[model samples]
Target: MLDPLAALRTPDDPPCDVYLTGSVFLDIIFTGLDSAPVRGTESWARGMGSSPGGVANMATALARLGLRTSLAAAFGDDKYGEYCWESLEHGEGIDLSLSRTVPGWHSPVTVSMAYEGERTMVTHGHEAPPEESAPCDPPLARACVAALRPGEGQGWIAAAARRGSRVFADVGWDETGRWDPGDLADLEHCEAFLPNAEEAMRYTRTDCPRAAARRLAEKVPLAVVTMGSEGACAVDGGSGENAEVPAVAVEALDPTGAGDVFVAGFVTGTLAGWPLADRLAFGCLTAALSVQEFGGSLSAPGWAEVAAWWQHVRSFDDQGRAALRRYAFLDALLPGPARPWPLRRAVPTIGFRRV
Candidate 1:
């Protein structure tokens, strides 16, 4: 596969852009929690809000970074699905022509509880993966596949690759139960693969995430395994060397969708012609900033914020480094505690505990 980033500078082709394909869901979040209730008992609720999530978050992140982006995914005709589609359609600058609405399927939904800005989610609606369609425009199609499925999600990717687009793939947690090792033939054609630590460990059946990442890099041109707080490692097939990028220090509130934000940041940086090291740093920074907010996309920082953070951290002289050490000291001294949201008064409490 050709480097989509390089292809962007080609005189004959139009400016390079990204096409996002996958699931988009409505995220309902409950906030203001004091503590999790004992099993079989009712819990109180503090607050609730709904926002756009899933592929919509990824696409929105890319668009917010000033990339030309299009979303290709499935939605239902239900009101929630309509809201999902409308959110993407009205997104600052995203293209939604490729999005399809399935007549009977319900749009995906995720209910989350926020504690100290960190969220725990319960999700539904994964039986409906988007149906593969014929290539629309070859270049656009290639970029599109990168966001959809690669390897196991191969049919569409192969089609797009054959049309000459550089493809990248973001592996999701659902793959843990859904993917079969034999289904990885299509991964051979991927230009880049992004899998979080848990996903990489599960897919490769290895306890060492770096080792698993190396194994994946052996297959694709680039493979990244992100380890929260420990930072991320990127293996370049061309150099056969793995490099580590340290994570930025930040107060983590909710970790929901941090990996997705990371993928969006990495891919955006990749398309911007950033080197591997810088790309990983930017990706980690993006994710760290994401946890400080409540909703997924709503938590993602804009390009200006991302750039400023990057510059500030990179400028760390001895005093700045000392400040970082002090910050780490304070964090260690006062380990943040988890708090569950209060339950609704009308909802009956149910108690259950697992050993």
Candidate 2:
């Protein structure tokens, strides 16, 4: 048995660039569907492909951006579980050695129906509980939390934070019905708390994203609430200040996993030591790029592509443009292709459309 307290004091090694522990799933997306059919009606769907989704997509996005990332999540011993592990292991910059494969239970899966780039999904896997013990090191163990119980997840998060690892927590919808806000003591130790607008509203019982962000900031160092087209707002606990970051306009092909991608970009930018405004812009940029493609992980842009898009958008002198450019240039260390028509097309209200 591992000494839980001793593990918390383990030396901070740079072997893994970033450690991410959360939900992983196999997403089957069907594009070109106008609408979902009735329960008894069968309709033919077109353009099908399988890709990583959920937290797995966030991990992949970070890895593709040259971060030596590791995934510490639960996987069943079944075929779908194996597919998830194999996909992450095969991808560049991802270390899956810490991932555990349990003997029973079905791995998470989702089926998405997309119409002209917009998507709706039906999912399953909430019933399956993750295994408590599996082969994992101290760091990986700190990352994976099998705690479906009220206080369990926060305990693991606390352990990770004590070990000097920068922690980002995503509060999913599963906790909406049952989670008590007081139980989230781990938020006090985390570097950032990212929740979708709906989750923020539920957690704080406030309809305004800004108010929710302020409420969250009272508990954590930084609180960010993502407002789809309205962009995102962040509250800094250190200064009691709030910043509104505008969302980049782009034709959203599929909004699935966009929030997760945004978290990925923001966390990655934070890890890179970028300013708050820049981090938010990078997050919005990554999310915009994600909706441009069909599947979640498949649609995420690599470091080169993101850098190119940032440069293309930076060559403008509009309001808030300088902050956006500085944020991109600071985090995007490598230079790449520059996009033409930086301001006219990049900062639109609806975003760029696919031709």
Best by lDDT: 2
Q: lDDT per residue, candidate 2, 153-191, as tens digits?
A: 445566666776777776766444854677566676677
Best by TM-score: 2
Regions more than 4 Å wrong, model 1: 1-11, 14-16, 32-38, 45-47, 103-105, 114-119, 126-142, 145-152, 174-180, 307-355
Q: lDDT, candidate 2, residue 96?
A: 78
Task: Report the C-alpha lDDT of model 1 over 1-355, residue by residue, as the tens digit.
Answer: 1122443566555343777677788887666776654579876666555667887777876666556677777887888787667666764457777778888899888877777544567888866744666454444432553543424454667766676777777665554475544546677667888888887777788898899888788778998999988989989987886778777778865666788788877887776676787678768877988776666765666655544453465468874574354233223212222111221111111112447
- Which pairs, if any, clash in model 2? 117-253, 249-351, 250-351, 250-352
Q: Please report the TM-score between candidate 1 and the true structure.
A: 0.77
**How many clashes does the backbone of model 2 have?**
4
Stretches of candidate 2 off by over 4 Å are 1-13, 103-106, 115-119, 126-152, 175-179, 311-332, 337-355
Per-model lDDT: 0.67, 0.68
Residue-level error in angstroms, candidate 1, position 347: 23
Candidate 2 TM-score, C-alpha based: 0.78
Clashes (backbone N, CA, C under 3 Å), per candidate, total 19, 4
